[model samples]
Target: MSPRRILFIQTQGENAGAQEISRLVGAGLGARGYDVSHLFFYRKSPSFDAPPNTRYCSHDRPRGVLGALKFPMQLLREIRAIRPDAILTFQHYGNTVGGIAARLASSAPVIANQVSARMLMNPLVRTVDLALGMFGVFDLITVNSSDMLMDYARYPNNYSKRLRYIPHGFDLKTTDLTKQQARAAFGLPPDVPLLGSVARLNAGKRLDAAIGTLADSPDWHLVLAGQGPHEAALRQLVVEKHLETRVYFTGELPPERIGDFLAALDVFVFPSRAETFGLAAVEAASAGVPVVASDLPVLREVLASDGQPAALFVDAADRCQFTDAISRVLNDASLRADLIAAGRGLHARYSVARMVDEYEQLLRDLLAPVPQLAPQS
Candidate 1:
């Protein structure tokens, strides 16, 4: 009856969505009495809290060769040291490393999660597709959404037979603060209707669409939270569309303060052209904010759900439609109320506790036949 050890791997120790999920998985599993260990590529110390049992491998990626020279050695040493019951990886590169390490270390179940669409990760996608073509290293490939799985129709073997659906869930806890209070705390005005979007400023995310949607309406304030490679391009688009006064780019905020941000926004807009599950949009809906987003099938599967539709989806590329969707949420108060209620209802389905329960069950089932897990270190 000792606690099972799970090694969670990541590359850059940044506070991106993937990193956040890794941190949450480690911390959450630890909270559930599992011995969790963390491994990073560059080995820089993380800003967020790591689990009690977390250990850093401190490996670095190599210049030319696909494998990290240091990680193999360090990971081998760590695996021998911890002898984890399983290894969980957050992204492609992490999966490659963790999966390979698990195979090298021995028959520890290696679980890999795919967070985004393969083709949409810029030009490097083909490289990933080719890498995924060799999935002999992976054990269980857990995806955040079925919509994400459906997208790999062209490359059916990207998942092979080890695919499993284990959606990433957010901590579902929010404050019962008034709109004015929430806005003031999150640094927003109570008067102007705020349309908030939280996503990396990447090409595939299509954040510029949010700015484009506001070309005609000068009254609505658009706040895009998070930073990425496309920051300069998005800023240039803001200038090009003459949205300097209406839109503000708040660089990536910490994960803890999201509730404050969600509370401040009257409407939550996700204009991303591509997403596997759109976890941020789910967070917004969980906050009970009216949600408007693209008609991307994956996003629709996650946010604009079938049982209870929470999102007003417009054509991803059509700014007119996107604008109309935003305007509809802003103009109609009754509609806003209905959307908020429906969003809350829909958001109820996605929570960290539920996700943890499901994932823990999966782990238990998979590890049922394995030897006894070690005690928490």
Candidate 2:
């Protein structure tokens, strides 16, 4: 028999968490002799090097009523052409529109990956998601965190039955570059205590909190290493606080360079207001950097292993707590050594190979033929 075909649908073809997960999982499936293809609704970012066998539905994200109407038809055509055995959709647009298009175009099972619970805050979006679940628009919905799975389970009706928890996996390879070398690559000072975050410059990330931490730690420098809508506002906050000289904006770093970025940092700060999974924190830990992140349950789930926490938890909104935690990790040698040691084995637990194995098993189980019951006498 021929190899099973899989297609991934995501919103933007950028170097974000969802896109990165799709790329990693797709590559894994391909290595297992599966035919994998990636489809994106928006144009691929010029800086992003998308995986092999990728296609875009539009030159840019749909802007108006006409563009919105046009997207689904284009998506439907792509779905029909791919004729995949299974379709995995990522992000909001991919989960909603992509799921609908797959349902209309093919008999394949559709698995919608929900990377965040923030959308539930919007009543209209929540209602639409529930309605779609009730109507069986998707065969399954995968959530990266157990917190998210439980959140979705709270909704009434068939929504609970379709929920599945699958943590995002990472390669977590160790970088050969030393802290000094990595700092040199980013044009950062060689000796200063560096705090950094590799996340989008969005309001939800609460990057402003990171800037606040720098205010109390005059000797430290902060690196904001991603691009998003909130860049201008964050830049303004840096200026307002008179931290323009200490804060560095590296725009968006490519996937390959993420390790070097993490290597250069003394502490990884993740002040996100919300997250379905903390991918950046995991990357930081894997790079042997101590992490100080928001005290969110989902974050706790991702940053801990074997009941021991791998990061220092703090309130994302409290700059004092953030500053104190960073100070503790930096000044206390024993604590810092323990955190680094604990984080060293994280790669073994959240490895890409493990993630791919789970995905492969899930796909097989999903596609298996149901055994029929014999007639009773």
TM-score of 1: 0.85
lDDT of 1 by residue, 1-377 (tens): 67888888765555567877777667777888998877766543334444355556663334455454655787778777888788777766676656677678867877777776776754564465345535656666778887765655445565556677777777653767777897777667679978888887788878877888787787888888887789999899888888888788767777776777788887888877778888788878877888998888877677754466778888858878888889999899888887777778654577677777777877887787646668888
Off by over 4 Å in 1: 43-81, 105-107, 122-135, 152-159, 304-306, 368-377
lDDT of 1: 0.74
Residue pairs with clashing backbones, model 1 = none
**Which candidate should be chosen as best, given TM-score against the real structure?**
2
Clashing pairs in 2: none
| lDDT score for residue 183 of model 2 | 94
For model 2, the local distance difference test gives: 0.86
Error of 1 at 55 (Å): 4.7
